[model samples]
Target: MAKDRFHPSSRGLSHHGMLPLFSHHPVVSEFHWDHSVWGSSWLFLIVSVLGYVISVQIVKMLLSFRRRPVPLGPIPALYNFGLLVASVVMFAGCLQSTMAEIAETRWLWQRSKTPFEWIICFPMGTRPAGRVFFWSYIFYLSKFYEFTGTFILLFQKQNLSSGHVIRNAMVVIMCFLWLQFAQSLQIFVLLSSTGLYITMYVYLSLCRMGYAPHFENALRYCQIAQYVSLLLASIVLIGLHYYKEGCSGMGAWLFGAFLDLSSLPFILVVNKQKKQRHVFNNTQKGSITSKTE
Candidate 1:
C-alpha cells in the first residue's frame, strides 16, 4: 500500500517546519495517478486541449463580429495575484519537501553524492507515491486551474496573455509524465519554474493594473536565460542517465525533453513579436516630457 512507503521517520523531523508538508497529510500520501483519478487519461488531455482551442476559436469568432473587449475591472490583476500566491506556496513546499526527501534517502544509496545530483537523477526504482512526488502531483493538478488565466485573457481580447493552448497542453503533458513516472529532473525544473513564475505573475499583475507593462521584455529575457540554463541541465541528465546506474523515469524524461524542446521556437517567436511595447513606452515618456516642458 502507498501508506507503507511514507510512514513517518523514527528520527525527529529533519527540516523543522517542512515535516508536516509530506508527513501526515492523508490526501498527499494516498494519492495515485491511475484510472482512479479524474484527470489521468489520454482522453482527458486530448479533450482538454481541443476543448480549449475550440472555445477560444468560438470566442474569437463571436468577438470578430462584436469587436470590442469587455472591461475586466481588476479581475486580471486579481487572477495574476492568485497565481502568484500559488506559485510561491508551491515553490516553498516543493523545495522543503524535496530537501527532506534527499536528507532522509541519501544514506540509503550513493551516500557521497550531493543533493543537486539527486535532483537531476533520482535513484532508480523511485516510486510515485512518496512525499516528494506529492508535490509533483499538485503541480500536475495546478495546470487545470491555470487555464483560467488564458480564458480571462481571451474574454478581454488578450487571450494569449502569458498562456495559450499549445503551451498549456504541453505543460499538462510534461507535468503528467513527471508524476506518472516520478521522473528525475522534474523537481529541479519545477522548482526553477516556480521561481520564474513568481516573477512573471508579479509582472503580469502589475501590467494588468496599467503599470510596468513595458517590462515584459525584461521578463522574456529572464525566461530565455532560464531556458538556456535548464537546457544545459537536461544535457547533463541525459549524460548521467546513459553512464550511471539509470535514473528513474528517464524514459518519461526523454518524451518530456521532446515536448520541452518543441517550445523553443514558440518562445523565440513570442520574444520576437515585441509588440512595440518598449517603443511605445519610450514614446509615451517623451510625450509626457514635452507636455511638462
Candidate 2:
C-alpha cells in the first residue's frame, strides 16, 4: 500500500491528537512509504533481495534432488485461484475508492491530463487515503505470496537465469517503490495489472486442466501493452517531475523510470517473437490443410 506523504509531517494529523475517520480528514493520513525501515531504506531492500535469492535457491536445490517430476497436484490451482481472488478484490476495491475520489475531487482528471500540473504534485493533501491505498497495501503484501509462483516454476524445472531472477525481484522492488511514492498513476496500473492477472490465471488454470486455450497471444499482447504503457507513463512522469514542485520521491520515480527502460526492450522482443511464431504456425496449418484437401 502506498503510504500517505502526510504521515511524516505534523500537518497531516488532526489537532485533536486522534486519527480522523474519513478520507477527507486533514490528519486522517495514509501510510508513509518512506518511513524508516519498511519504506525506501536500502537496508530493507537489500536484505529482501538477498533473502529472495537465498530462499529461491534453497527451494530449487531441494526440488532438483527429487528423481520424479514434482507433482503439481492441487497446488497450482489453489495458488492461482487464491491469486485471482486477491487480484479481483484489489481491482474492485481500488477502482471503487478511486472513482469516489474522482467524483469528490473533480479536478483530479484535469490534473491527471496536465501531467506537468500534478503528476508528482500530490503529497498527502486532502486526497483521502481511501480504498485505493488500502488495496495497494494489500497488493504490496501480496508480492510475498508471489514467491510461490517462482517456487512452482522451479518445481517444474524452468530455467533460472539472471534475467529471470531480476524480473521476479523487480516486482517486489516496484511494489515497495509504489507504496512509498503512491503515485496517482499507479492506481490505474494496479487496476489494470490486477485485471490482467485475473485474465491470465483464468487461461493458465484452464490450460493446467488440459484445455486448449487460445488466448496465449492475447495475454502476451496485454502483458506487452502493460510494459509499453508504463514506459510511456514513466517518460511523462519524469518530465513532469522536473518542472513541477511538491511531488514526493523524485528519486524513486527516477529509479522506476530506469526500470521501465530496462524492461521495455525485453517485453518488445518477446512480443515480436510470439507474433512471428503465431504467423508461422498459421502458415504451417494452412499448408497442411491444403495438402489434405
Candidate 3:
C-alpha cells in the first residue's frame, strides 16, 4: 500500500499477522475441549466408563460366591436400566441445545452465512464437526462394549446351549456392524433412537414374566425366537440398504416391526405352555382325589 493501512487484527485478514482460527471463521472452527458440547460429552464418557467398571466388578463378585455358573440376572437388569437413564439424559441435553440454536436463529437480525447451517441441515453428506464426531465415536464404542460383554459371557460357557451361544454371537455381530454404519454417517434416525427402547421393553417384559431373573424353559424359547427374528431383521436391513439408495428407511421400519412381532409369539407360546401344564397338574390332582375317595 502507498500508505500503510492499519488493518484491525479482529478481522484476521492481515497476511503478515497471526490470529486465532475462530476469528476467521467462527462457525466452522475446530471444536476444542473448552466447547460446551465436548465438555458434556467428556463427562458422559467418564460416567459410562465408571458404570462399566462397577458392573464388571459386581458380576465378578457374584460369580465367585456362586457354586454353579448362574446368569447375572438382576445385575444385568440394573445395569441396563442405568444405561437407559443415561441415554435419555444425553438425548435430552442434545434436544435442549438444538432448541436453543433454533431460538438463536429466530432472534438473529439477519441470516449470517455460515457453513455450519448447511452441515447441520445436511448431516448425511458432510463431515460433522469434531464435537459431533467425538460423541458419535463414543456411542459406537459403547455398542462395542455391549458386544464384548455378550461375547465374554458366551465364551465363559455361562451360556451353554447352542441356541444361547448362537443368539448372543449374532447380536454381537449386529451391534458391531451397526456401530460401523453409524460412524459412516448413515442416519437411520428411527432405528438409532428406538432400537434400545425396544430391547429394554422386551427385557423388562421377560423379567416381569420371571424368565430373566431366573432361567426357565420359557426363557430359552424366547431367546431362540429372538435370535430368529434378529436374523430375519438383519436380512431385511441388508435388502433395504440396496433398494433405497442406501437410505435405510425401510430397514429401520422393518427392524422395529420384526422386534415387536417376534416378542409377541415368545410370550404367547410360553404362557400357553404354562397354562397347559397348570391344567394338566390340576386334572391329575383331581383324579387322584377321586380314586382315594
The digit string of per-residue lDDT tens for model 3 on 145-248 reads 45344435633445233333333333333333332322221222322343444455456657755776544554456545555655554554554445433422
Cα deviation at 128, candidate 3, in Å, is: 4.4
Best-first order by lDDT: 1, 2, 3
Candidate 2: clashing pairs of residues = 1-136, 1-137, 3-31, 4-31, 12-27, 13-27, 120-247
lDDT score at residue 1, model 2, on the 0-100 scale: 12
Give Cα distance to truth, residue 154, candidate 1, Å: 1.9
Candidate 1 lDDT over residue span 60-165, tens digit each: 6777665677788878777788889988988987887776666555555445356777788876766677666777877887888887877776678763733357
Clash pairs detected, candidate 1: 154-159
**Cα error, candidate 2, residue 218 (Å):** 0.8
**True-structure RMSD, every candidate:** 3.9, 6.5, 13.4
lDDT of 2 by residue, 1-293 (tens): 12332233333233336532334333222433444423357677778878988888888778878866688889978999889889887777666555444343434335443423333244433232444556666787788788787888788776565666677688778777766665545665687789899999888888878996899879988887887776676666655556544455556566666776787777677667768888999999999999999
- TM-score per prediction, in order, is 0.83, 0.71, 0.36
Candidate 1 wrong stretches, greater than 4 Å: 1-8, 12-24, 159-163, 209-214, 275-293
Q: Supply every candidate's count of residue pairs whose N, Cα or C atoms clash at under 3 angstroms.
A: 1, 7, 0
lDDT of 3 at 95: 38
lDDT of 2: 0.64
